[model samples]
Target: MKLNVEQRKIVELEPQGHLAVKGVAGSGKTSVAIRRVSFLKEHYCFEPDDRILLVTYNKTLLNFIHYQFNQLSEEETYDSFLSEHKTDVTITTIDKLMYRSFKARMTRLGLQLKTMTNRRQLLKVMNHALYDMKDNYKDVTILSPKFQNFLLDEIHWLKACDIQDLNVYQEIDRIGRATGSKGMPQKLHKNSETREAIFALKEHYDRLMLKEQWVDFPTINLMALREVEEHPPEGYTHIIIDESQDLTKVQLMYITHVQTDKPHQSIMFVADNTQSIYHLSWLGKGRAYTTIGFDMSGRARTLSKNYRTTTEISKAAYGLIEHDEAILSNVDFVKPALIDRHGHAPIYRFFKDHSSHLVFLKQEIESLIGEYQYKDICIVAKESRFLEDIEQYLLSEKNSSPSTQSSKTRF
Candidate 1:
């Protein structure tokens, strides 16, 4: 694929210090990021120990980026760039990077880090903490089963944003949770009583983890951030982060510390704020660039052209969130301009009951099976339970062998 004008500008940007690219879906943000890696290698002179790093959010994206690099290395157009600028680039997910840092820190402290791979074990610890909280906290709302998930989210958000002080958390506005006329219940962070209870629960949870020498995902990030802050890494000349909107504040801090202390080192973050589903408030508050300590005065760019979805699809997707007051209040919404292509407008069908919906889904799958391969057809649901219901119905009633590989099943 050829680079568009905006993408070319990003790829060839000079002095690439703290560059942030905000582009809609299919705006070639990832492509521009990958090309910039090659551009840095080709144009910049590096010491023998200098390193380049590419950080992604998940394994799927990490694999896709590796595939892109492989294709670039073999392509005739990029052969010269690949051969001449042969600098080592490290590609990894944020989770793996944090885990490595956490492990190294633990080793240095002579502590054995117990990895909790089982969800049930973590849940058991949480339940125990809640049980203990019932006696210590005055708010009975925290004891409700429905409040568990919300409490967990608040805890994770606090840690992700590096809000260790309860006073600071209470003073800050909760941006991600739904408020006002949205009809959704107000979040617990809004209520002083519940906020106290949540903080107590977090403390209890932490004590339990400390007692057991166990570390969960969020704790790993917090530990890693502290480790990196005290002992910044070395030899990194350039760092590129894709899907940066999904990253939390602590993770971003870890990225900053992992880079070398060179005066001319560069870091680039490519993100679409509209696609941020991780619920980080800094991006919604229009302070994401500054929050990461980056002065994006002349380094920021936005890609307006969307080449992925058709006009109809783009409009439909935008329509879903266009009037969402919560979303509008937080994100600087940029409406994408689609290429001159037309497709069928998204369809919405309503069924009276679950059985009817399954029947319709079965017929649709049977119809699509003839035209497309199994892997090409995906069925998405708002929750995993819905997908499980669909899978069970298909297997027991329809006698079909549908694959439920992930939340978004492909069969």
Candidate 2:
């Protein structure tokens, strides 16, 4: 992929104290970040020990980064270079990076750390804590069973904000809440039995965590932040943060601790606030803070032209999201015109029922398979149940196909 004018500038950026880049979806922020790392290693005389940490939003994005890195380093010269200096660069999701940091300091900090691997485990812990509360504390059956998820979400929000203490959690206004279906802010009631129950559960959860030697996901970020703040990390030459708009305060704090005030070290943040769906974690309470971390002196830059979507698609998207003030403020104050590369308009199909939906989907898949490869087509489901059903249908379709067929159609 050839670097566009904006992307080239980012790739060729001088290794300053920090660089803050706001890029739209198609602006090649990842490519720029990767190229910048390569440039620093090749030009700035950065040693293999000076780790270039590339942190992204999630594991899927981390995999994408790894794939891109692999593709870039496939050449003999770069392959040998990356092979020899493997540890020189670290590409991972923020959670993985934080967990690594927390794990490294766990023994020294005298903290028995255990991370919950899945939602089932997390729910189990929450239920056990709730049961303990019910058995010990006043039976606050006022808190409905459905509120279990909301309570857990609130806990995560508090932890993300570094509000571990019960008093602080109660006093903190706003609580970084997400909106309910009624478009009302979902918040914890002050001085209510519900609040008390939640507090007790938090305590129980912590006790259980310590007892079981385990920690939840969001708590990992909080722990990492605490560790980094107490002991400022050293040795990293540069940090490239992707999808930074979705970062919580704790994650920002970790970044703050890692990146020193010195000019030699570099911190780069690549994000599009418009694409920040993670804020929905708190029911719309969280927004991308301008002064991410300790300072805002980082050179601010924007990538305006979107290279991925068609002009019509871009316009449609913009129209849909333009009403969001948070996106407008964090991304581009004055909605920048995206110079989208022309392509097919997005297709929307509606079905009366699940069976009809699957029939339409299968037919569409068969139709599109003639022009585009299986990898080129994607069927998006709104929920996991729908996805499971679709997957089973696709599997059955493949299984029923004739064995004599030379090529197999894949989903």
Candidate 3:
């Protein structure tokens, strides 16, 4: 497919330091990223062994990016482009990158090589820490179960943003949990007393994690940031990030540490703030959630033309997002003109009971079975329990052969 005018500019432009691509959904940000890499390959005289790193949030997205690169290379007639640079190019989730860094420094740091075996184990540790904070500190307020969860969540958010100091954590507002994101209102940590207590609990939790040698997700990122600061990775000329809006500050620290500081080297961040699901890690309000401090002065580019979904669907999605005042403040809110394609309008159904909903869902699946493959169809649910219910219904009632490789119903 031919590149859109905006995407073409993004591919052709040679940014001096960093380039931030703020693209709406289906605005071809991914395509632009792939082409930008290809453009460098063709024009930049990059060495055969020069590193080009691409980072994202998840394995699924990484796989999709690799597929897009393959398709783009083929279309551009850069035959064997990926194969030639296979060793030089790195496309992976931030977690894997952090793990690699952690592994490299594990011996020197004396950090235990371990993975979180269960989420419940961490939760148990957190609860114990909370209990200790309440016992040790008379000033620390005893918290309810709901408030305890919020405190733990806030601590994780602090760590992601590289805020380990109690003073700094207490001073911050929202702790990167956007008001637009899910959960109850901003009722927790209203007073300095509450924040102080939470900070104490956080310190306790940190101590417990260290004592147990338990490695959690936030610890991985914290360790990765430290490793990058102490021993920067070599050979990376360019760094391209997808879903950049979801990235935490410490993650950006790692990316900055690894990439070369040469004048010609390019670093690109492509994301749509409206699709940002990591507001909790942002630790601030409005645009601060999406803008990394490192990329504050980067050249900003916005891609508004959407090439996916119908006009009706696009309007509906945009309308829903606009209704959230906090989210709208951070986004460009450009109402995209959808590709001209006729399709059936969406339908909504409400059932009085779970049984009725399951019955309706099963009937709908049966109707589409002949026309579509099971793997091609997707069923999304707001809650995981709903998905679990669907899974149980499908297995028990339909005797469906569950695909081990793919999640038939993914959240």
Candidate 4:
């Protein structure tokens, strides 16, 4: 369990200073971060229960990480380490972390009370504001009259993502469907690309909410960042931000001040520019998306040798990603050294005809499952909706499960 070369370099480079780890997918950033806490615990001689925040954008990922460590904390693996040091560490999503930070600092920011809620309520509040203002909305929600129907549909989609309260969804639907629904924007277009922008506007609305005595997520962040600058959080010694590629411009700006204000505090940022998922949020006025590489391997380090997939799988994955210049433009990490993968040859096919393509695809799937006994086959489609038909066929093929994200498929 001693550190690997890359992990050791990362530790040696910045045990207590500004550091950043950048690498491609499956490059072991999580392992590095986990090992980082373990290393620091021993080196700093810190108590096991002291809190260290591990933040990520996705809750699903957070759950997996907790599962990963829980295994270590269990009897089969590093149970002894968990027994002796279980009290020392903590991991949580960035949103929760930010909310916690905001709660602690709310009083400092002239707030009497800090509250947290989901997105559904915020949308309703925004819609209400638009209604009361008679659709002017200062050009906020009512982006245009032409796209009001689209807006309602998008609202439904948002509701789907936030289904905790059917009452709110029903209310929003009722209000949105009312022929007299008001405050439509004149400029916004309803399209797939506009989805993120809509969510961001919701974020922006959250920020402006406080000015009019209404508040939300972006508002919490805006004020919280300022509050932290004025009054730093106590107890926490270092800050390491993961999935930094997914951070928004405002979030980065917030982190910058937090890092500089705390002296002798280690600030480690690990991000992959190629995986900058929120790149559009950095467009136009701000040069935030093209986050300049912070070569903190100055404590910046990497463990690029992926020990996950075999040589063939790694090569196939690499072939799909590396040769494509567009995806490659954002990454600056080494391709994993292809390892031996049991002499399996990955067959790829390209079809000029759609009918032939479907036939060929089914044939391949049948060949793999029938000829190779590959029972755990997961066909991940980019457009989630595409899996519906495939799922049906697979289920009809015999004993597949019906539990797809779109529809149900038992496999």
Candidate 5:
């Protein structure tokens, strides 16, 4: 397809197997993408309904792309019939994409998934507790919704921390939706006899969704990635990745797996290195592309533009970050736009005398919130130790002054 200067290079550039787009905030990358897609449909000769999946690192970006697509279509003003009849292009967050693929395979794995999977497990445990107390149980469906949701949320928190087997088999079944390493199943046991008894009651709740089709968020990625590694997507021509910086090592491995068989098509990786701040796995030695092994079919384009932010805000924000400037040097397209944002000239207070500080704080609070009619004022202390001292002092002051509104002071 014929494209304008920018779109032509992104879609039709030489050695074009994968397109790696390194775009800054204001680089018009989205405009380029829309033009590229439209060109492909109009002239590049892609089937209307080819499995062209547009995946984003997060939901927010996914939404942005969806909005972009809508706006572009509107501007182009394609016939309503052609637009409706065209083969649908799938645009979604990576998680949702993996979820679709994983859910399919998980159905064959003999697991059931329920809507409120975690809560159901918790209810079974509660039921077991009730059984122990009442001796004669009437039914399982009589539990309160509020209590069940609470137990399920509690299970989710603990599961995240790996403290206990929070989700049931069905919950894990639903987890087959993500692309990553398939985690080991939890051993069903408890600290006390009663807890064990509760667990036994809850274990059967796994067979609720379907006899063999349950899946979960993490498992979805694990299975989908595995499938691609075993048998890559058929006729997979190109891969365009957004939010590349936020993607994990495992996630990258999965993408690599997808491109292995069809290494000739193209790979497009678009990312803002400054946006997604994650811990670098390598301590000091730099990360090598060959070590992880990336064979490129296309050039990795580096885009630099300050589209969103003003020079002043960008200058100030850049100072706060610590990184190797060589690896991360890129012109920002979007920087903070408003004048003097984020309290540029912040008030700095230092008091060596404790009594004097307390006196000043009390007077300041009273004047700002009470006399000045300020609805809310906050004093932020980073550490817990400092907050604790402030809390104690506030309590002592309020106790001494019974006339003051004790509820007004919130540390």
Candidate 6:
């Protein structure tokens, strides 16, 4: 693909300060980030020890990026650059990076670290801790499902923001914690009684985790942040963070401290605030770039033209969040300009029950299978259980088993 003027500018950016590229979906932000890495290797001379790090949020994205980088490296134009910078660029997810950085230190300290992988198990443990708190505080409201859920979210927000001092958390302005029919009932920073109860619940939860010898991702992230602060990692000349909006305050802090002390070190953050799917409430409505020591001012760039999605799809997606206050308040939010391509308008269906929904989904898949290959069709659900249910229902259908035709059908 040929580079656009905007992408070329980002690719050729001088390797010296921070550069933030806020682009809409299908705006080729990831491509620009990859090209920038190639540009740096081809254009600049690096010390033998200097390295580049490209970090993402999850394993799926990490694997996709690795594939893309490998493809780019295979180009004949980059052959010489590949030979020199093959091992210099490290691509990894934030969780894996933190775990690797902290694992040795944790083992040396005689800490038996066991990460809780099962979601149901973690929730059960959390609920047990919450019930224990309720018994001690004599607050029946703590047992309310809504309150319990709010408490869990609040605890995550506290850890993600690295709010260690209880006093600071109590005094800090709660950005996303609003109170009304739509918001959380208890404000941890506002009501003293509520705040105290929540803090106690947090402490209790920590104790339960310790007792079970279980460590969650956020705890590992916090530990890594502290470790990075005390013992800053060296020899990283450049860092490119993709999907940066999903990063927590502590993660950003870790990135800042891990970069090398060399004069020409650079960091690029590519993100779309509107596309931020992780840590939605935790980041609140605050401008993360400035708060985390990035001076975007003139260094920021926005990509408005969306190349991947059709106009119909883009408009439909935008319509859902066009009036959303949270989305509108985002500092990096951009109304994407649609490309020339046009596609079928998105259909929104309302089903009374799961059976009807599954029936409709099966019909749609069977209909589409004639025109498009099974590998090209995908079914998405908010939860894996729903997808599993759909898969089973489809497979159980008499004389209409999609698995019999092709193994590529995906959920």
Location of the lowest summed lDDT over 10 successive residues in candidate 4: 279-288
TM-score for every candidate vs. truth? 0.89, 0.81, 0.86, 0.61, 0.51, 0.87
Model 4 misplaced regions, further than 4 Å: 1-3, 12-16, 45-51, 70-88, 104-142, 145-220, 252-264, 276-299, 321-335, 339-345, 351-375, 388-411
Q: For residues 1-411, could you state the per-residue lDDT of candidate 5 as single tens digits?
A: 123465457654543455556665655565555455554444433443343445567888777766666555334633442365255444557666665555555565554453333645546644544444343333322233333433333333222222235333323222111222223223323343433333433333333323444443333455666666665654334456666656644455566665433333445566655565443221012232343456433355655544456655455555555354534443322222333334344344789887777777766766665445424666667566766776677667876654345455344
What is candidate 3's lDDT per residue for 1-411, written digit by digit as tens? 468776898889975767778777988888788777777766763565467887887888888776776565245533477677777777789889888888877867775657674767777888888766665657544444445556667777778778777677666666344343345434445446766777777777888887877777777888878887887778478889888767777787788788876767878878776776664534223454234544444477888777777777777777776677666666434446666765667776899999999988877877776687677779999888899999888767644533322435432
lDDT of 5: 0.48
Report per-prediction Cα RMSD to one decimal. Answer: 3.8, 4.2, 4.1, 10.0, 12.5, 3.2
Highest lDDT: give the candidate number. Answer: 6
Between prediction 3 and prediction 4, the one with superior lDDT is 3
Clashing pairs in 6: none
Error of 6 at 204 (Å): 2.0
Best by TM-score: 1
Superior candidate under TM-score, 1 versus 4: 1
User: For candidate 2, which ten residues in a row score worst on lDDT?
Assistant: 279-288
What tens-digit string does per-residue lDDT give for candidate 2 at 8-39? Answer: 88888788777778767777878788777777
Model 4, range 1-411, lDDT digits (tens) per residue? 334677667755545656667666666777677566655655653443244445666698777766666555323344555566665444566667666667767655566654435556655655653344443344343444344444544443442223233333333322112334344433333332333345544444444455556554555665566666677654445556677666654465555554432334566667655555442222111232334334343455555665656677777777776775545553334456554544575777677975576556566666565344434666766554567766656556444422322334354
- Candidate 1: list runs displaced more than 4 Å: 73-87, 179-185, 189-191, 280-287, 329-331, 400-411
Full ranking by TM-score: 1, 6, 3, 2, 4, 5
lDDT of residue 357 for candidate 5 = 76
lDDT tens digits by residue: candidate 1, 83-138? 65456667789999888889878987898878775766777777888887777665
Better of 2 and 5 by TM-score: 2
Q: Count the backbone clashes (under 3 Å) in each candidate.
A: 0, 6, 4, 26, 47, 0
Error of 5 at 384 (Å): 14
Q: Local distance difference test, per candidate?
A: 0.75, 0.68, 0.71, 0.53, 0.48, 0.76
- Candidate 4 vs 6: which has more lDDT: 6
Question: For model 2, what is the error of residue 328's alpha carbon versus the real structure, in angstroms, after optimal superposition?
Answer: 3.0
